[model samples]
Target: MTEPILPRIRPAIAALAPYRQGKQAGPDAFKLSSNENPFDPLPSVAEALQHTTPINRYPDATAGRLRARLGERYGVDADQVHVAAGSVSILHQLILATASVGDEVIYAWRSFEAYPSLPLVAGATGVQVPLTAESRHDLEAMADAVTERTRAIILCTPNNPTGPIITSDEFATFVARVPGDVLIILDEAYAEFVTAPDAVNGLTGRLHEKHPNVVVLRTFSKAYGLAGLRVGYAIGNVAVLNAARATGIPLSVTSAAENAAIASLDAEPELLERVAVIVERRTRLVEGLRAQGWDVPDSQANFVWLPTAERTDEIAAAFGENDLVVRAFPGDGIRISVGEEGSIDRVLEVAAGVR
Candidate 1:
């Protein structure tokens, strides 16, 4: 018997690899692969989640209340704030909204692993500019790379995996060179973890006001410890955000997630104290790694990058064998999130052995 033929698939999508999440650890291991908040859900968030009702009903497709609260915080109109399941979901929407066949989306390579694939899924070409030797974006090269076909550019600050923030001065100069029509997405998923004075503060810096084309993406998944609930928001021009909303799936942000996010905001002080603890731990870990002769990047985010290069697989395996799970990019580097305080010693020990 002959088998039935499969329907046609988009060639670009067929060739594209799905986004790979950070590795999970066993019960005995610390899950430092994903840059997640080490603390559990805030009591306020938990209490708020308990009160969620109307389970049979769809969520507010616009996530109005959350957007309003975010708008008040960011000094933007409610229309300028758009909430989605997560910042990543918003990324997909924004890419699809602005890019199309024959368009180009430019971003620094070895930045977000998901950046390259998102454009391909939208039938657009991805143009990756290489990161500098310090594991930071080469903004000059990126500016030179832009062409008439460039539709959007993604700048991930406190950049993922290799954690180094794009300085505010650098971003200002880069933004000036880009075409006014091009959309600039500042992905600041780990913004809350940054304590560096010079780092770009997208939320409060009023970048959107200065650069009408700029849109800032933020998430509760990291600092708020709401990763499982998937709540994030974007701040941008009303028109641009509306275009993103048009491309989004309806009712993707659940009521529970919205409530939890609001509660998290209400309890910001305590949540930020937890962030301070993580920042301290990150400093300790980085210092210990440097003492162990590792060339760790000066990360302002809640993680550090070790440029393991060809030894990435070997070092990652060594970490795994020592019951420490970390994200590894073969022939490149390793990203170890600042997790439980107890896990830091073990990480330093394993890293020391690798050297």
Candidate 2:
């Protein structure tokens, strides 16, 4: 007998692959596949979670308190701050809000894995400008690629998988060349870990004030150790944020997450000291990798990029055999998060052999 027909699906979505998360490590292994903070929730954050109330009621759709707190921290008005379940959720909302079937979204390649997929899911064409040989965004090439069809552009500073940051001067120059009408999303997911003096600080630098189309996306997932809570926010012009809010899923940011985020802010100094520890560990790991004769990038984030090139799979396998799980891109390289201190020696040991 003939099989029954199935419901129709969008051709673009039908051909698209879902986002792939980093591989989980076994109980005996160190999980460095995801760029996660190597610390536990602050005591204050934990205490805040204990006080969550009204389980039967829905969360504040506007995330008012959290927005006000973040706005104060960033020196922006509360209406300019938009909180979502995670910065990634804000990304989806922004893409859906600004882009459409015939429009285009541009970003650097070998950057965030999610960048390409977001546009496809939104029915917009994705334009990828390749990174420079140094594994940094080729901003000039990116500027050249923008056309009238371009609806949005994403700039991932202290870029994922590869850790170099976009300097303020470079970013300023790039922004000047782009058309003012296109929406620019600056993904600063790892901002708190940045120690580079010249690196672009979207919030403090007041980039949004200069470029009204620009939106800065940040998260508590990295430095604040709130990955599981999924708390992140966007600082932008009020109108742009409202558009993103329109596209967002209602009440996605739970009250518990908001409370924990507020508490994390309250304990920022203590949590930042934890960040300093991770930064130190990252420096040690990078130095060790360099001593092993590896051409590791000068990462400003809490991770290092090993340009293993054709040897990516083999090196990744070597790391896995040592019970150190890392994120590997088949033809590119591996991105190892600076995790537990104990994991570093093993990482260096494995790197020695790979080199």
- Model 1 residue runs over 4 Å out of place are none
Kindly report which residue stretches of model 2 are placed more than 4 angstroms away from their true locations once superposed: none
User: Which tens-of-lDDT digit does each residue in 64-166 have in candidate 2?
Assistant: 9999988888788999999999999999999999999999999999999989989999999999999998899999999999999999999999999899999
- TM-score of each model, paired residue for residue: 0.98, 0.98
Q: Could you tell me the lDDT of residue 217 within candidate 2?
A: 96
lDDT of the candidates, in the order given: 0.93, 0.93
lDDT of 1 by residue, 1-355 (tens): 9999999998887888887889888988999999889898878889999887589988888889999999898888999999999999999999999999999999998998889898899999999999998889999999999999999999999899788899999998999999999999999999999988999988789999888899999999999999999999999999999999999999999999999999999999999999999999999999999998888888989899999999999999999998989999999999999999899999999988989
C-alpha lDDT (0 to 100) for residue 152 of candidate 2: 96
